[model samples]
Target: MSRIPVLTPETATPAQAEIFAKTVAKFGKNPLLMSTMTNSPAMMNSYLTLFQNLTDGRFDKKLARKIGLAIGEENGCEYCISLLAAIAKLQKLTDEDIELARHGKSTDAKEEALLTFVLLLVRHKGDLTNAEVQAVKDAGWSDEDVSEVFGHLILNFLTNYFWKVARTDIDFPVLRLYDQSKIARGNH
Candidate 1:
């Protein structure tokens, strides 16, 4: 059960309602995470801003989705895995691709490098040696790519922590990684 009630835009405060509309426009639906976030307008807006900044920039959608999946899976948040998987499907990611991304492996070399970089954070709990950073660069990702990885991970962490703290109900069908080790870098 969610620790808080999930509110639809119609029932939300004005600012939250506007953000809910933005969420719907962005994702086609106001997900449970969005509804849950309606509790705080500032939070909703902050989330919306970060999402837009990351997506509107030069992010490769495929890589971004894969990064999201890796973060969700490694952190063990079911809600996030399900939500991200569904979104990835909407972006035309094949089931094969989604599966590969769950473990941070990809047939695409660039995606593989990015996923590896993001996964290192989860696996090592954010401890990175300089050599580790250089390896991602050696794989051909630029410093800009690394900076965006931080943005994506920060986004992932928000929902991961939300799931951990709320134990929110699974609104998405639930994308369970092969291992029950759990999922969610955030609720979404």
Candidate 2:
């Protein structure tokens, strides 16, 4: 059960209904995460805006989805991990690819570097050093890519923390990486 009530098209207020409509337009359906986010219209709107913008940014869809998985795993948010895995499948990522991404790795060296950088951001709670920023650049990432990674970090962290707080029901095909009780208890 969700700590926050999941809003539906019929049950939502006009503001929330409009947000749902936008969500459906963008994602083809209102996901449970999006529905739960409607407890605060501002939060839903912020999430949607960043999500839309990031999808349109330089990183390809596959890499973007991989970034989601890496962040979800690092945060130990089962809901987010499952959600991102479903989306990763939709993006045609192989099981190997998905698994590697969950561990913040990639077969491709460039991608692995970026994934490593992303985890560094998560582990350090964004307290990265100047050398850390330059290291990813040395791995062939540009300033724009770094900026987009930060954008994704913020977007993913918001969703991860929300799931941690909400304990929302898993609506996707559950992708359990560890004991759910442990994750919920912050043992990850």
Candidate 3:
């Protein structure tokens, strides 16, 4: 059960209702995060718009999802990790790739470097060293690419933080790479 109640469309304010409708129209379902944003309707609209625009058919969605999953793992957000793992699979990411990304490892050098950079950013909350930035650049990422990766990282952080606050339920399949026993032992 969720620690914070999920606000359904019926219970949402007018602003939230519209956002919920548009979200379902676009994504085929109202996302769990949106459902949890009922307390702040304006914040919900802003968040929905930000996410929609960020994912608006520019970059490879699969790669973005992989980045999100990797960040979720690093953040230890079970709900976000599980949801993005499912999204990665739906985007045709291989089981091995998903597992690797979830653990912040990737077979591709560029991807590995990207995840490493993201991990450093999350670990330090943007207090990245010059060496860290140079490592990503050396891995062939332009400044624009780094910025895009940061955008996805921010998105993942928002969702993961919300999940942490709401104690959201896992609405997607658990990734095989996640060891439930270890999580339980850690009291997470």
lDDT of 1 by residue, 100-150 (tens): 999899998877877888999778987989988888899988988888788
Model 1: lDDT equals: 0.82
Which portions of model 3 miss their true places by more than 4 Å?
A: 176-188
What TM-score does model 3 achieve against the real structure? Answer: 0.87
How well is each residue in 57-113 modelled by candidate 3, as lDDT tens digits?
A: 345787787788888887767877788877788888998988888877888898889
Residue 60 in model 1: lDDT: 73
RMSD to the true structure for each prediction, in A, is: 3.0, 2.0, 2.7
Alpha-carbon local distance difference test for all models: 0.82, 0.88, 0.76
- Candidate 2's displacement at residue 58, Å, is 1.1
TM-score of each: 0.90, 0.93, 0.87
